[model samples]
Target: MKGLPAGLPSLREVLSRHGLDARKSLGQHFLLDPVLLGRIVAQAGDLDGRHVVEVGPGPGGLTRALLATSAETVTAIEIDSRAVLAIEELRQAVNGAEGDRLRLIEDDAMRLDLASLVPEPRQIVANLPYNVGTPLLIGWLRQAASWERLTLMFQMEVAERIAAAPGADAYGRLAVLAQWTCRADLLMRIPPGAFLPPPKVFSAVVGLIPHPVQPPPDLFRSMERLTAAAFGQRRKMLRGSLKSVGGEALLDRAGIDPQRRAETLSVEEFDRLAQLL
Candidate 1:
């Protein structure tokens, strides 16, 4: 509310003026509710003195909410040139202290190294584009040490996968990688109606706090490979599914049952197998 200039055009007006409609290919779903935007930002906890990174800021609805906070800086990355042009007004409207608080980058988030964007105490808060959300999250999980927290919104199914337990249907590579490197929690569930061009499915917000102590880089890589093989054929036993990796020999080495299915193994069990790799 206090972040943008007085009488700045509403999100819908801005989109209409810029000829911007939600792009399905880009997984864009614009959220315009200021109160909802503020609530999403709240999931990130205290932003004071922390640098925040936002990805796929379609109309800057969430970006505006982030600017309203006490964050040290908010760097927004947008792949679409049209989106960049649309939010330019919001960036220009902020003068004085808030002026320098917003930085707009026109680029792809997947290729960019987020850690290099700012120093420690950095966090990523975004309504990630649905198409690339998982890969973006995986990249962030690998470099978990670089972040203080990760507050992200994804399709409800994907969010469930990230926070799912060992036996849950949603549990898989996403959960294994996320939980292995960080503490993940399902923070909020949002309905389809929240967005300007609502998606057919619901969305949920997940908060991840990276563990202070993490496995070495090689171990993380091994875990990735292991999970891939195991879940590649979720119905098969570990011995059959993981055959390409190491098969029965690997299972014997890790002291895990050869008959166990991929979904049945806990995160710790997965780590144990990864260690043997």
Candidate 2:
């Protein structure tokens, strides 16, 4: 692992020099603690040969940590122009030591084709922007094979939804889809104070490693539709909730109880229902 280049400036100094403040419109909350940043990177497991992709790298706090790893490359995608300047400075600071290992892209993460951007053996690690986090994750899950692992930070509630079990209130479409495609876990809980200009809610990091065996494209689509109908009206019995998908007849076909609610069904049960579709 390459040490951070000598005389690298601190995150605060980077932000200050760039006159960058966390922007609520962009859902930006800069994580300024080096220890926490390192811990987040650790959650992604060994990065020795992985190409790390970071989104919304405000002032490149986590970017700095990633560069210190043995990761083959760290590609940061930032949409905010001002913050991009801050990260540019970081890129320059480490250019000598990191060489081609650090690449900065000033673009919106949601609009880019990630698979094409970062080749195989890729891992995504980021303190995701709050507003677009779930949407971005859902997109990635649809193409889970493209990534080796995903270690991301989100609001504590969102993290709970990702790792929640069948009987939990937090379990729903996200939990079903996420668990179906990958092994999801809430890795660490971070306090609001950990961020510069703290957010109102606590944040937690979630780690996801895709299962070796994944559903076929058709089955995955069926699963998405099934979860949408079932959790769309989560309080209703599966018979009523899934009426548009297939209703009680479909449940009878799959040997599931029609009276059960969406939250009560296991990932396997949902898969069973999806297969019938």
For each candidate, the alpha-carbon lDDT, in order, equals 0.91, 0.91
Per-prediction TM-score: 0.96, 0.97
- Quote the positional error of residue 191 for candidate 1 in Å: 0.4
The segments of candidate 1 whose C-alpha lies over 4 angstroms from its true place after superposition are: 1-4, 95-99
User: Per-residue lDDT of 1-277 in model 1, one digit per residue for the tens?
Assistant: 2355567788888899888898899999999999999999999999998999999988889998998888888889999988999767778776443657788899999999999998778999999999999999998998999999999999999999999998899999999999999999999999999987889999999999999998889999899899999999999999999998999999999899999999999998898999999
Output the worst ten-in-a-row residue range by lDDT, candidate 1: 1-10
Q: Per-residue error at 249 for model 1, in Å?
A: 1.6
Candidate 2 deviant stretches above 4 angstroms: none
Best by lDDT: 1
Candidate 2, run of 10 with poorest lDDT: 1-10
Q: What TM-score quantifies how close candidate 2 is to the native fold?
A: 0.97
Model 1 lDDT on a 0 to 1 scale: 0.91
Per-residue lDDT value at 187 in model 2: 96
- Clash list (residue pairs), candidate 2: none
